[model samples]
Target: MGIKAFLSEPLARYIVAQQHEWIAASREVQEKWRTGLVQKAMNTQFGKDHFFKDIHSYVDFKSAVPVSDYEDLKGYISKIKEGEENILWPGKPLYFAKTSGTTSGTKYIPISKDSISNHINSARNAILTYIAETGKAQFLDNKLIFLSGSPVLTETGGVLTGRLSGISNHHVPAYLRANQLPSYETNCIEDWETKLDKIIDETIDQPMSLISGIPPWVQMYFDRIIARTGKKIKDVFPEFSLFIYGGVNFEPYRAKLFESIGKPIDSIELYPASEGFFAYQDSQDEEGLLLLLDTGIFYEFIPTENFFDENPKRLSIGEVEIGKNYAMIINNNAGLWGYSLGDTIRFVSTNPYRVLVTGRIKHFISAFGEHVIGEEIEKALRYGMERHPEVEVVEFTVAPMVAPEQGGLPYHEWLVEFATLPNNMEQFVQDVDRRLTELNVYYDDLIKGSILRQLVLKPLRKNSFIDYMRASGKLGGQNKVPRLSNDRKIADELTKINQ
Candidate 1:
């Protein structure tokens, strides 16, 4: 190991030990954070309006602050954007993490001085946890590239504003600065293809050991690298050993990614968002990510089944059970109280409070009462791909075909873009359909009762998703196509692109 790796080993162990202390005292830590956040924001407009002064316990807090999404908080957010002080939190926010929204056009989530550490430290601890467990710190000595949004930021109401990843760029510790790849100038390029080309120019010959990004974009980088050198990724960068990824499930892209690399490698899954860094994969042996309870955030859970209910049952950390899906609600130090994160997660292990991100709360398909989820579809696709090792998928989305243009019973339509087409497409579809039926009982009942026809897979041209995203002006920089939809909006647009 190099000098940095040798030094990090001891530091990594210390960090892991600190993490354990918090994990063991999860409830106490969360309670402390909740009290601190409430007290700090009590004098703010939102806190005063919501009677934060009267809130003393979890029950009081819950009853005082009703659950709120972006729309519900728009009034306060607008005041903050207009240079108001203490509208939501005390004083003005340090920065606003901007993101695209579905119903709302754009969202600006605040990041305060107090809450910024939560984002940075959670990510740092995840890697340190790996190093502590596996005793693998040598990778830190070499080049590490995080394929991310632009480091360039603009100002909004006197606050620096940009994508969360971009804002994080400003905070890379001095120790890692020398080892980080893809020059800042390249990162500042607005166009993704141009930026990627510049990145290839800068790093093609570097001794890179780690690469991090969403899987699809990373796959694109791998494809470009192979095209340039005519060598597998591992062959080009023998030291490249760790992949850090987030924002989507990695299962569907696994086969093609490993095939391109010519070997398997270690990976760390992260659950970072504009609102907070919620969890990170702390153990390679563990099936889910370790939720960061001690972060400057208080978490609540509502069973996903009752999530749509007007008065959903909310549970604190002590009340959450294993293997049940829950819509997460959070009150963070940044002053977002009773905020619905919109992502649904299932607790895979309760001892250390580990969770698997199930899917978006709004991104499921219940058009026919089958109620298929993103996890089920992803697993079923992985199952089919495993059975047919010859097939490689690029991207896919599912939507209900309520009225087939060809005139037939309503069914689910799968728009799939393939990296390599399956030789026996019919068998591939059958395998996927069978697995999905087994995974979702309601879907099986619908098929058996003839209420819905078997799923139909439409093979899309290569780069179909890319074309669609590009056409929508969301070609890169933390933007991605949703995996499934309840409506035909995305599906119809994809069909148009393929046409």
Candidate 2:
């Protein structure tokens, strides 16, 4: 066998073997995992305060370590930022991943050597798992293009801060360089539009097999590629068969992205955040990502319905039930302890532990007691798509049209940018409204009682979201518009931009 082929087989075998172990692991086996990770960090300052040294079981771990947010850990992280060693983890962090400052300003998350390895291995395992499942080993033959963040990193208080993609780009195996596109030098360019132009010029004629990024930015790249070459994306990269995406739900952007492709191609949704590689799309037949149970990260779940209680109960992986919204708490080798990543998820399957990312904890819309999240918006849109196959909705965001001082009930304002609007736009809105009511009982009650006005649909010019993001200085690389917001803040901003 050739060298690449030889390398691929063993990795695929290893991942498949691990998958079997994960699926068969008993509740006791998984709980022991939580204990083991806690024990490893027991020597750190965080561990000492939380009495990790005295912990013996999952019950002790949860009761001792309080669920924390970024602010709660900021003091300890500040010490690490000032060159403190062994505060959160042993020795100093090699790098700090700067998060997109959507809710909590830009956060500098420490990335230890162990955490870096976890990210890389998890990514490889994902690909190998795909190979084991689909037998598509041909994917390794062509270039893989990642439309990533600017690699030009900056130092802050002895820590390097940059986008997660830029921060992790250098750690990838050098052997894979031959098949990776957009030279390192080009990836460092600050201006996204300029960088995209350079990337299109460099990759439009290459033997590309994969394109991976957040969907909106990927759509922008696809749009440019089509415009530049005057041919379909499939024609430009015939080997381009798989799209790996994360940092946002793929459902809303899927139809818009497919409009750029000449033929059908498979896609995978990843659940990776700046903290670590959490989960990934393991099976094409499945709707949710298989939670990474064995990685350096340990997980706890706090049901969203009871999140604000004086003391919310935290459940371990083995105890979590399917169909409940839980805010995630992660403890990782990256020195994060009980850190509330602000993301929410629901267990779609419990036997093997698969989860669907529901949305961000701070990103839901509950303005009128109708709690609508990112997942609901996506599901509602998909339902609308099922009813109208011809309509190609490109991008959208929703905000509440709160009751004006003049009077009348409040309703939802949907700003949609479509590649082609449905022939019956009014029916399209009705379909969305009907689906949303079906998904949210509170919403159904409101509409039935006439307590809220019917939903309003506003068709935006194509690339309106793109234009808004670019104007806000967050046009690319894991940056996404919040799909649902409680207030009119973002909606008013976008409305003004088009004017």
Q: Whose TM-score is greatest here? A: 1
Which stretches of candidate 2 lie above 4 Å from their native place?
1-3, 405-407
Pairs that collide in candidate 2 are none
Candidate 1: segments with Cα more than 4 A from true spot: none
- Top lDDT model: 1
Question: How does model 2 fare in lDDT?
Answer: 0.83
If scored against the real structure, what TM-score would every candidate get?
0.99, 0.96
Please provide, for model 2 over 1-499, each residue's C-alpha lDDT reduced to its tens digit, 9 standing for 90 to 100: 3366557877798878978786788465557667776777888888888888888877787778788888888898889988887888887887888885655687888988778877878887888888777877676777888889987788866777787888768766777778888999889888889999999988988989888888888888999988888888988899899999898877777776887887888878888888888888889898799888777778889999878788998888877998999999988887788788889999999877899998988787788899888888889888888788887877888898887556788888889888888888889889999999999999989889988877888889867887888888888777888888888888998898778
Q: How many residue pairs clash in each candidate?
A: 0, 0
